[model samples]
Target chain A: MVPIYYYLILSAILFSIGVGAFLIKRNIISVFMSIELMLNAVNLTFVAFAHHWHQVSGQIFVFFVMVVAAAEAAVGLAIIIAIFRTRATLDVDRIDLMKL
Target chain B: MHLVLFFIFGGLCVAGALNLLFQRHPINAALSLIVVMSSLAVLYLLLGAEFLAAAQVIVYSGAIMVLFTFVIMLLNAGREDRTHGSKAAYLVGIPGAAALFATLVYIFLSYRTPLGDAGLGNYLVTTTDLSKVLFRDLLLPFEVTSVLILVAVLGAVVLARKEH
Candidate 1:
């Protein structure tokens, strides 16, 4: 049996990595992937707690999160495609029109 | 045996995430994310969420990642040029994230005793039990999510339509 803190620690580390990646990545798609990473980390935390407390609701919440993530991915990628079509670029730095 | 499997998949998950962080090309980053997601599926299995493990594989690594790669190839996106990105990200963001991680680790470690240990095979959460709860108790939310999915489908179609 592994201590539950180990899973929590791993989740925290993954989340931090996700934040760093989201901040640093320039490409829109890469940034989008970082968001996915963050979502996955949160999902891990939910599952860990679900297992810890012996609650099926935690797992069910994860299921809803996944459903939302799927919808988000579809819409987000579509938005990315729209942005690419308009800007002709994927770099977040270059895509800024209202930054000024 | 449980501890060993946890460490292995956990290590793989972290490594894949780091790989996603450092990769120069969007395609490479997407692939790394797939690795991370798959490793996470295994972690879900380790945590006794069997249905979630399968869903993580099918939904995340299978569907979402394929969509990402398809976009990358369709757009013909190239490796990121590092020069245009702001310096503040490295200067502030890395330390900020590290600080956040330290804080969370400390908090979790402090509460470790109450959290306790998880032993496998003691009580597994079977799918039948999950469906009973999901369908019986949470039926409304379930139906709402289907509506949400339909809206997402419509939104994607509308958004991705070629502008006239």
Candidate 2:
């Protein structure tokens, strides 16, 4: 039987990869993808614990997390589009309007 | 059998995540994200969270990922040559990520919490049970989530509209 620790380890690895990609990638889209990766890692952990505890609460929480994730994706992508339209570039370095 | 299925879906999830990280094209990454989401749905099923499994598929694979793909398509963002980051960024990020991963693994390994031996048994809640609890006890959170979704929809429309 696969132990629960395996799932936790996998989630941790994936989360770190997402964080690394988000930090190092210059493209806005890549960064967004990394964010999705991070969210997925969290979902994996939630489901794993839900299974471990034999309770439905964690699964219900996963449902709520998914709802928020969908909302985030919609709003975040729209913002990305708006930024791209004005700058004509998705590279993070070129987005300097916020720099002071 | 359960272990085999777990390995299969887990492999799929890891592959999809790696592809998302390595792929240069945003659309390809978005599609890979869908694969990851679907595999997670499978994981949810394995965990006996049937409702959550279905919800994961519908919300993530069907709705959220499609939204991402559409945005990528609308933007028509083409693949660019791999953008090089400064040496400092990679130097810091690589080690930082590695350290974080190591720490997490160590903590997970060292934690000695005994797994509950009761198993799921007869306590597994059916969809009806889930609905009852959701409506009866968790009604406020459910309604708040709906409102959040509505706000997100409005914000997305406003952000995407072309300014006059």
Best by DockQ: 1
Q: Tell me the tens digit of each residue's lDDT in model 2 across B81-117.
A: 5545635567887789889999999988876356332
- Report clashes for each candidate as comma-separated counts: 0, 0
Residue B82 of candidate 2: its Cα lDDT?
Answer: 51
Off by over 4 Å in 2: B81-86, B116-125
What's the distance in Å from true for residue B58, model 2? 1.2
The regions of model 1 sitting more than 4 angstroms off are A98-100
Model 1 lDDT per residue over B30-54, tens place:
9989988999998888889999999
The TM-scores, one per candidate, come to: 0.97, 0.91
Please give the lDDT score at residue B76 for candidate 2: 87
Which pairs clash in the backbone of model 2?
none
Candidate lDDT (C-alpha), each: 0.92, 0.80
